[model samples]
Target chain A: MSVVELARPIEKARATPKGPRRRVTAWHRWLSPLALLVVWQIASATGLLPERLLAAPADIASTAVELTQAGTLPTAIGVSLQRVLIGFLVGGTAGIVLALVAGLSRAGENAVDPIMQALRALPFFGLIPLFILWFGIGEEPKILLVALAVSFPLYLNTFSGIRGVDGKLAEVATTLKLSRGQLIRHIVLPGALPQTLVGLRQALGVAWLALIVAEQVNATTGLGYMINDAREFLRTDVIVVGLLVYSALGLATDAIVRLLERRALAWRRGFLA
Target chain B: MATRLSGVARAFGDRVVLDSLDLVLGDGEFTALLGRSGSGKSTLLRALAGLDHEVTGTIDVTGSVAVAFQEPRLVPWKRLLANITLGLDAPVTKAKEALAEVGLAERADAWPLTLSGGEAQRASLARALVREPELLLLDEPFSALDALTRITVHQLVLELWARHRPAVLLVTHDVDEALLLADRVLVLDEGRIAHDVSITAGRPRHREDPELVALRTTLLAALGVSPEGRS
Candidate 1:
């Protein structure tokens, strides 16, 4: 009520300088990577590290530029990106559909969950030989491998997310007389989204890893194939460039998912943004 | 009567939660239920809300029913406004109006997790009353709030119930809260109504009023808490 009381809050606000501190923290994030790059450049310049074993950061950068100019990098990247996109679509949809069927009913869960769990325990990449035998060395096995890798995390997370919805909230639905469809659309799906996003982030990581492995095994194109071909020529710089491309793509996909999370979960004020 | 339950019996694994409960809640009447823990108060409320369906009962409610639980079960993922009108055909404008009615118009876009306990409970009340139900069941909706917030919510509920005129069944363990809010107070014991007292006290009745004090003493005795050591 008093002016002094109001002025005290303003005084406190003036005392706390938040903006500069936040900007400093943002800048600090890149400090470690830059340090690592500087170390690598120093080691290469001093000739302490042999060029044949590992490419210098500068050489990798210039080689990336060269590969881009030659169109090899861009074409390989485009192919790899398309494979991940399709694999994600196929795997993500199946995971959601199976999660819904299992999460909603005990009968569906009983019929589906154990088999999924059994399959989930088997390292999917180990089936590459079987896949090659069955589908032959083509895009089919590679895409399927990526899809298989992406599915399990999503299925598990989505299933748990739906199961973890508050029973009290569901009781609210009962009182509202929400139809079955309304219940799923409004309550179940949104409640499951937080966990589903966790699964999505994990699936994104696996999808990229799967694509790298699938392309490495029997591929004429993509970053994996480029890295493999450079290995024969002992072109460490080109291999490093290929690996960097994969890492950048992985980071990009994860960043996209993070953007989706922020948009979908704006209602949540999590401790970490 | 807006709600009726006859020969209603519910059990869980041979443990009887409600035994042959028979009651009728009058239209637009505010009724409070008081009981000890494990006295089947929640079982009865859940039955009325149709949340407990395994019960054998002839239950009839005149129209739609809404319930607000003790924990203010607003979905964490929805903003307060969306939580109020979730799964209902109501528009955002109606949700905003409901929030305003509960003195939370400024919190329409706020997340449920950001709300204080009292604010969340208010949002819960708004969520229920927005449905314009014929019956509104409250399961200790204010028990989690501090004393000051509880009194504010008591007044808010009174005002809302007065305007809406829904048949309200409030389940609480607070004797004073029951005496203050309800036109009729029912005490449950041993899976049935043990005391059904019609409160004759007028609106804005003082807690210190002899009639309320006497009724409070009676209700406390029914709850098996001795009233002998008080001032």
Candidate 2:
């Protein structure tokens, strides 16, 4: 019998008992968050909570609809997304390329790694003043800020991932007589991919953070610009809407990475869900 | 001869592992090497497999050499069939045939991590056999298996070896395992072959047979273990 066939009965047996209990726990997981939202809504309706400090959920929802209909929200989303995408592409590419250069050869490591390590130690946000002075308060500084923020996580993860590839597998490659390029392609890079994906996820997160920080400074567009405009007008509802959009975008990107992980790492059986 | 090593010397800093070790392997011959824990069994095997180059020696092999390590060493990312065909220009049918030979045909699409220990080892063997090596080096591949699985795999290996006629050198610690599977057994000690014995018994030989039992005692003695369990 096939191994899968042999394993079927046991899997069915374990799954049956866990199925209903899992559903119960999944619902329970959302209970606290839902309860908090209800309480906040009630407090807003009863006038126990003031709108200036925090807008009610109903107010935030209505503001979200108004902004969406007025085309402001959509435009801001589009602008912010473009910034992140371009920055991510630039930074992610640079990170992977640098990681490959350092990971693949001793000379590459000696030439590139020490400088990267030193640069990584400086707080990335601290570079904003220097960036503004260097590149001006245009899209250049904003995008470059995001790119710089995104690159380090990817570089660190991909580099370590390449180094962490099993040496035994490398020996197997040698025995199989794989060429140096083939060895890197088949053994090194694929083995390093899981960590690189981790780096990608972190970079995406940091890209959004960097965009927000960069936008807060002398900005003309994007969600941060919308929030800055909302603050001058004391529109707590609009500010909350902008923050909610940022969080939703973050969650959406994370979900994309999770989907990619599921597809790419399906070979890793028994990994936690 | 399939392989020959002359005056092979290997040392790890000050400690000598293989001191002037000389050995020869006949074509299609099955040899079992036994040794105490630190007796350079793996060192010699690694040297022959071309994995260790620091050794000073004249070593020659007739054709391709394939090694199956103790852990199977199948790339965990690759499927069973892909792993078998790794680095080879062979067609998919050849890898499929090799998997079938190892009794893992149905698991050709399965990931390496999903396989049981025995199944993984069989896949390792399939990988080695697919190359059709002139020399097959097994570095204690079966030691990680449970007893029942080990016996089954032992039979499977013998069957494959019989068909392929590869010059097989199996490095193992078990005395009975060596006697059961090998035509010739060599005991390694302190960096050299301390003793060599030929097993002339027929196929499907029993452990209880007077000849094998006597040879086992002698082999055990050569490995510095008393037959009666006394020091």
Candidate 3:
């Protein structure tokens, strides 16, 4: 209430609008990538290294266009995306079931959790060899590898989400005399969905990364395979083109999830926004 | 037995919050729980609402029992109408009716976050009302509101209570609040019913009337605060 106390906060509020303008100088957000591209082009023109070692941005763009015309680009991307989708679904469902079991029953945690934790600790990429041996180097192994890569994120998030749900809300549910199933459907699921969504997005990202690794080895036609094949022929242009497609796909998928999250959480807008 | 809790003794570790407190909320009586902080008023409401399991009591009630938490814990994800309708298995036309009672029918579609504190509390009241509860447990229902807001809400609550007339148990720290509302005010001090004061004041009773003033003095005295200069 004193003038000194009042003045400081008032001054800060007045000054705060200027802070972002100063901090986020226009080029900081939009121009850094364009600058990097310029440097890349300049380096290619300098020719200190062979053209194979460093593909110019223009060369990658041209290769991308050629691949698009041939129809290989979209097909590779589609196959990779489909595999990620199926694998994420398989793994995500099982993770949710396990999270619920562990959340509801203490015995389930004691009995099943240690093994799950141990499996979670084992590098999913390392499991590729075991999967290859068991299911053979084919689509099944690749799909399983994608699933294996994704499962931990889903399980961890789902489990923590269940654990982290407001006990106060659960008490509210109980006071209403809701049945167990009703409690799960109305209160528990919605309560956990926010965090579970975070897990789902994270799993999708990991799955996309894993799909690349899975497809790179063996009789596969995917962006990953294209990159690996390009590597053998030393076609840096194609490799750069594949990396761009991979990164773009990952970015686009995450953007979609972000949009869904925003829409799903609309009711929370009044409080959190 | 419409609503009953017998031989109820609730303790938290070494602290006995409610001990051997046998209570029976009659079929249609409004009972106000008055107590100081740590007097286990909220605890008793929680027990009756069946949210607390630590209590050793048999709470028997006819139909559903709905509670309005002290903080108006409206489901943040639900729209105002949806939050009210959440507990009803039988579609309640009364959801809008309840919202109207709380003067929030206009805000039926608004997210709870957009609500003022009073509005949020009103929405919570709507939620309990929609359940058509046989017993309604209110824990410090108006304690969080400003004095002006509290008065308005109190009038609204009294009107709604008149309509529904569920066996109501309201808890509050404010002595005057307990006095203004209930047919009978029960004061708890350290887990026991230290004083049970019956306010024989009629509805729309004037606060400055000699009898009601005397009764207020009596409650203040019972709480060990002398009504000397205050009166």
Candidate 4:
């Protein structure tokens, strides 16, 4: 006999929609940050907040402008960005390849999954000393550290994503007589994308964290080195500028991924409806 | 025969779903399979579609086959037109033609999730029909719709079947549906055909047709259900 149709009462409930929510005005999101900046400027003007403890927003901005003029801040940012790009590419590629290998075959999964899971259990920071000892405090250790940090989250997420594809959809592929490559390209990968994007966002965050920690341990370039140099000279203004740059970079990368998600998953209509 | 299966047997860990079952369909014939749930209707359909490989049978199919399951099973990530033409060697215009045939020509660009149940099933039917298979398997494709929508879909399927002229195996348990749609109806019981009843009633048969009503009674009785309460 035919199966009973599942009643989606939730769709009906959603149709009887409520009034539109109160929209946040254009300036609302920026208001809090602007208010904090004004407070910082006032404190610094009154000399109530010491520069050694916390540099004022104005001083930090001036320091950033001076550094950019001297080419220090721009050079550091360029170097840091380059490192992140290289590390992310290497790690992301490896993660995707490994995920496909494990996701597609029982033999590949049996051979690879356990070792990766064991390695994943090790804290990323714990590898610092070993990395330094092996790679000798050079660019190798720093980039490798970032790559390693980026790989695990992407690998886990991609594997789970591939696994999470609907079996019924796969059956459709088989009934359609789709070849293995066609099945992978048309069905499996597209099905895995929503989960894989979740992994990507997480990996990007972890990548920045790893880069920060790696550069802090030993580096002569990049944002972390600039912060380290500022600490040595007690120039809290330069340090605050470096911190803000990091935050801005983080925000920018996150925004990029969110945009990608919107474009790629336009077909998804769940709560966005 | 457009499709033939002989001594087909399928089991899951010793629980036989289909046991030495044999079925044949003539070219351009509309056949309906009726069975209670778990009586192996889907199992047989899957075996016929070559989706169930572990079946022990010698099956001979004359040409390509396409299937529409109870669910629409359209790829959620694909547009309706793309879903219809997926893996088919047909051009975009053909997909448009199939959509027009299914009365969903305007919805070709819409997402599958955006369509209601009946509309999505129409899209699914379009997907199957675009292939122009010699055998078309319908695993209760209209069972999910409301009664009114089901009648509309029934009419649509009859129209499409008349145009395509593919040998159809429509798996359903509704006696009136079988009387309305199929030239021949088979009742599956205990993993075998318990009754093979052919309806000679004229085309466009109504639910209230005297011959159809009698056939429904006989079909219901063969299904081991009393016609008194149900009719």
My TM-score estimates for the predictions, one after another, are 0.91, 0.95, 0.90, 0.92
Candidate 4 chain A weakest ten by summed lDDT: A18-27
Q: State which candidate has the highest TM-score.
A: 2
TM-score of 4: 0.92
The best candidate in terms of lDDT: 2
RMSD (Å) of each candidate, 1 decimal: 5.9, 5.0, 4.9, 5.6
Q: Candidate 2 or 4, higher TM-score?
A: 2
lDDT of 3 by residue, B69-152 (tens): 888988788788888887577565678888888888799889878998899998888888888788888888788999899899
Error of 2 at B81 (Å): 0.6
lDDT of 3 by residue, A100-208 (tens): 7876668987776787899988878887778888989767887888887777788888878877878888888787777888778878878888888899899889988
Query: What is the descending DockQ order?
Result: 3, 4, 2, 1
Clashes of 1: 0
Tens digits of per-residue lDDT for model 2, B1-231: 669999999999999989898899999999999999989999999998889979898999889999999999989888889899889999999999999999999999999988899999999999999999999999999999999999999999999999999999999999999999999999999899999889999889898999998998898889888989953
True contacts kept of 4: 0.66
Report the lDDT tens digits of candidate 2 across residue range A200-245.
9999999999999999987899999999999998899999999999
Question: By DockQ, who's the top model here?
Answer: 3
Q: Which candidate, 2 or 3, has the higher TM-score?
A: 2
* RMSD score of candidate 1 (Å): 5.9
Which segments of candidate 4 are over 4 A away from where they belong?
A: A1-21, A24-48, A269-271
